[model samples]
Target: MITKEDRERVAGWFAGRLPKQWQSAPAEITIDREEITVRLTIPDVDLPKDASDAARAEARVGRAKAFREETRKQRMEIAREAEHRYDAKVSWGLALGDHTELWTHIAAPVMTRLRQPQRMVLDTLVDAGVARSRADALAWCVRLVGQHEDDWLVELREAMASVADVRAKGPATR
Candidate 1:
């Protein structure tokens, strides 16, 4: 359970540690239990005002790829330092114009025991070809719920944080 202060501190650390020229804007840092993802927005490619949409799109992708390759060594060094300090794996991404790409992120497996009704839901997704297997179906379902209920989930997380704060303030059990 990461506190709000912990999140802010991590963000601040990245803001100061990252090279100024690397990001056109502040880095977007997302932290979970096992990973910390840092997404930086690179400056848009300078193209002619009358450039075609396809050309612009291609340039954006090229720019992001170049950035990734050029900074791979330096990024690895930074990620190693961050991972050591934070005790979590570090993932990197880039956002160029309207394009975003995440590379070298983890796909951690989760285990669960589902009841018959829950199993049926996943089976339905697999049977309908929405996913390749029950595991994929469960992931798909979670993603779908997240997309639709993001606001509610955020509120719930905030409430949980408040509960953690209250618990911390109470008398020590130990």
Candidate 2:
């Protein structure tokens, strides 16, 4: 376990090298086996709050690229120090804003009642080495379908929206 003092010292080392605008941003230090990872997140200010979700995502991509270029030298210095001090592999990645909209976090758990045959198919996928377990196989299958049928998925979502709109209009009175 990393001591509080050590974590603080590591955080301070990187914090001083960060941009003045990001001086107060939080630092997360994690140690695993023989490597230490230090992550510093900065808010992406390029996109307005009112920007569309796609626009925000695109802006985040641009901001990450720009930040890496801007901080390359300082980050390399911190990396060298971390390696020399701890004798461990050190690397870092940046996150934009609160990171709520990252692709992995965007997925919500879906609970569905499946027929016995469907359940068996998921189990078979695990047995065949297609996935680690039934849940993992189900996730893999969903991802496969999503990747191969994005246009169909979009149409399905539009249809669902239309159904909801019609339902919200209420039934015709006799």
Candidate 3:
């Protein structure tokens, strides 16, 4: 928002820059400081579209531009920072130990698919504190291997082992 002083300064400055032809033109200008509104209207349009009219228009635009420089720069910088933060691979998965949230999310559905035997195994581990936190719970449930036996856990371990073995023998011959 511009102050009344700024408004008068700009209006007077603009009026002074107009050509002589608009000297007698009745101009209505209102500057709403809070809204940063600058309204300029020539209540008397009887004057010719000579140098004064063009000059006055130019001056009004110039004043507005000058006053808006800081705002424009701030807006552009904010937009640039937002773009910098967005990436396709935004480290969405666990890094050091952010797996806690992911576990809770997966658990809601996995509990329904478990067989009775698997459920008991999971319950025992969960009770024995094998799953220290959500992350640990998810690790025990999905990735624990040898010595982590309990049919379901064993199957998961074997599945992961198979994947590792496959990866080890890269580009296998047909």
Candidate 4:
């Protein structure tokens, strides 16, 4: 992907960017036209062996490799959990349509699993003019057919916080 002249030109450019303290640093660059990428690498070098006594110094590259694998595993697990929770929330909300369906499907399950305040919050969203209807509240607050989880969650949190502030201003009337 590179000619000898291209390599020399890039290396010259890189050498100028190095610090004064790094006078001995190696300058290397590779350009791949097909990928539209330029990779620059600085070669690692060890100090000269002293008269005291030494064989050769080797890198613990495997340790760095293992550390990368561990970070990857943690990231994958977190992503999987988020996706599963979002899927279940969307499926549950879809089963709820009207009163008859809600009573049979949504009410018992929510009452069993969710805390009182959480259930009340969902109910309040439906009662307010913020949402078009019960299904709209579900679609807006959580994941369902029409909405994205991240954006809808942001809007829902803002609306809920505003509702709390309004309630604090008003009387204790239910």
Deviation in Å, model 1, residue 113 alpha carbon: 1.6
Worst 10 residues of 2 by lDDT: 99-108
Best-to-worst TM-score order? 1, 2, 3, 4
What is candidate 2's lDDT per residue for 1-174, written digit by digit as tens? 444455567667656655566433666665544666666677765656689988877777777777678877877777787789777677676677644222111234567888999999999999999999878889999999999999998787667656666665788767
44-142: candidate 4 lDDT, tens digit per residue: 233354622222222223322333354445434532443353221111100101111111112212213557776676678877876765556655665
The full ranking of all candidates by lDDT, starting with the best, is 1, 2, 3, 4
* Residue pairs with clashing backbones, model 3: none
Could you tell which candidate, 2 or 3, scores higher by TM-score? 2
List the lowest-lDDT window of 10 residues for candidate 4: 91-100
> What tens digits encode model 3's per-residue C-alpha lDDT throughout 1-174?
333454466456445533343233423333331111122222232334564856655554544444335334543443244225321111111111111111101222232465778667767777888875444555566655534567776476557656766665688766
> How many residue pairs clash per model?
0, 0, 0, 0
For model 3, the stretches where C-alpha displacement exceeds 4 angstroms are: 1-89, 92-112, 132-138, 146-174
Per-model TM values vs. the true structure: 0.93, 0.51, 0.22, 0.20
Instruction: Please give the RMSD of candidate 2 to the true structure.
Output: 17.2
Off by over 4 Å in 2: 16-24, 100-174
Q: What is the C-alpha local distance difference test score of each model? A: 0.93, 0.68, 0.41, 0.39
Candidate 1 positional error at 167, Å: 3.0
RMSD of each: 1.4, 17.2, 29.0, 26.1
Q: Model 2 TM-score?
A: 0.51
